[model samples]
Target: MEERLQKIIARSGLASRRKAEDMIREGRVSVNSETVRELGFKADIGRDEIRVDGKLICAEETKIYVALNKPRGYVTTLSDPQKRPTVISLLPELGARLFPVGRLDYDSEGLLLMTNDGHFAQQIQHPRFRVSKTYRVKISGRLTGAEFRRLQNGLDLEDGTFVPDAAMIDEINPKSSWLILNISEGRNRVIRRAFEKLGHPVLRLIRTAIADLQLGNLGEGDYRFLKGWEIRQLMSPRRQNERLGKPWEKT
Candidate 1:
């Protein structure tokens, strides 16, 4: 069946669909020896000889889903231009190309999902899905009652409003405080930025869960393939909402 060249490349486990589109625009993808740069171009996956970066494409027979307890200082990318270590380095050779579902900054650590299935990655990463992500954060100082209420209600930041599904103080120290926050938005550096705006800069941040999937007992730098039921829970928005005890109206 004919499909967009980017989709074909993504299904082949070469890259995400968005990355494949970027490859097309950069004139790196070719079809039957002809370079195709248009985003609207389509081709038969079975008939056309699709190649990305000069390698022929074929759909991966086995889709891989992994949950990695990403440690700090590792980039949540397949490759890093600066030569820093990446999450891909921690995984064994599974014989299939896998990419991170979302991102954790170089300094943040915790549960990071990696997958070969482009559709699955898209479903989890896209903000529209409203998949809740919980984080255990350490900030510079304790938040005043008013400040805590603001975070619970929502914060109107320079970019957009960031409203946590839930927010609470986990521990209060003399010099620092710990908090547990749950949010579904995927804005870059959102959690860190939110705390910084409130005069308490984030000292540490660790994502503890994504939807119903927890980082339970997964040692740092260790990775394990997701079970069948876990994959289904992540894929179904209704199921996720049910587990979170919240109703999400599709926008």
Candidate 2:
């Protein structure tokens, strides 16, 4: 069957549908040796030589989904230009290429989802899905009640708001404190910057859970494939109006 080019790229796990659309607009995506910048372009996945950045993407394969207990100091990208270690290296041998669903920064660690199912990744990433992520953050100083309240009430960040769905101080000491924050909207450096804005610089941060999935006792750098039941749970139609709704469109 013929599908949108962005859909093919996204389904191939090369990029999100939105990112694929932008790449198309940027002339990075080509079909059968010809650069295709047109939105809503369609192609047959099996016959077309779909290349992104000059690399031909293989035909769709059985989707792979695994969870990694990411340790700090590993970048989330597939390949870092500065030559930093990426989370991709920590995976066990797998035939399908896996990409991190969202991201965990170099300084932060914990449960990170890796998968080759572009549709699955996109669904979890969509805001309407309401997939919340919880993090246990260690800060340099104790948080005042007012400061914690401000986090719950939401504060303006330079780029956007730092509104946590829920927040609580787990523990406190003279020198440091641990706080738990939950937010469904996963934005870059959101948790750290949110606390930083309140004078509580984050010393250590670890994601504890995402939606119903927990980091569990999985050791750092170790990963395990998600069970059939787990995949079914995540794919539930929490929200359906949005690619695989808006394809080849700007995010």
Candidate 3:
């Protein structure tokens, strides 16, 4: 059966669906020795030869899902061009290419999901799913009452409005303060950016959970395969909506 070239590449575990689309547009993907740059191009895996960057791809026989406790200073990518340490270096070679479901900043640490299943990655990362991520952040100073209310009501950032699902002051120190925040959107450095805009500036940030999946005693830099039941719960749309108390509508 014919399938979209990008979908085929993602199913082959070569890259995520989004990355595969970019590869196709860059003219790096070819079908039957002919470079095909059209995003809608399709081919049959069994009959047509499909190659990415000149390497033939085959359907991946096994799908892998992993939960990694990413440590600070490690890049989230499969490989870094500047020879920096990557999250892949912490995992034992499982013989399948696994890409990060989303990303955690290089300076932040915590639970990060990795998978060979492109569909799963796409679903979890898509904003429409509204998967909530919880973070424990240390900011330079405590937030005043007005500032806290602004964060709760939603703050207008240069990019868009950021309203955390939940926010609380955990502790206040002489020089810094700790806060717990939950947000469904995955904007780039959003937590940090929000705090910076509020004049508190994040000093440290660590993701503690994603949906029902928790970091839970998982040692830093350690990785474990996700349980079957956990994967099922994450994939269920009904369960996702239940967690947020409403269906997510894209703005």
Cα lDDT tens digits, model 1, 1-251, are 89998888888778999999999999999999999999999999769898888998975568999999999999988788999999999999998889999999999999999998999998999988888899999999867777887787778889999887877687888898888888888999999989988999999899999988999999999999999999998898576542333422111
Q: Sort by TM-score, best first: what order?
A: 1, 3, 2
Q: List ranges where model 1 is wrong by over 4 Å.
A: 1-60, 242-251
Model 3 per-residue lDDT at 16: 100
State candidate 3's TM-score.
0.73
How many clashing residue pairs, candidate 2? 0
- lDDT tens digits, residues 1-251, model 2? 78999988998888999999999999999899999999889999788888999999888677899999999999999999999999999986798789999999999999999999999998888776878788888999877777777877888999987777766677888898887777788778988888889998999999888777788899989899999887877787752211111111111
Q: Which stretches of candidate 2 lie over 4 Å from their true place?
A: 1-60, 238-251
Candidate 1 displacement at residue 221 in angstroms: 0.3
* TM agreement with the true structure for every prediction: 0.73, 0.71, 0.73
Give the clashing residue pairs of candidate 2, or none.
none
Q: Provide the global lDDT of candidate 3 against the true structure.
A: 0.88
> Residue 163 deviation, candidate 2, in Å?
1.3
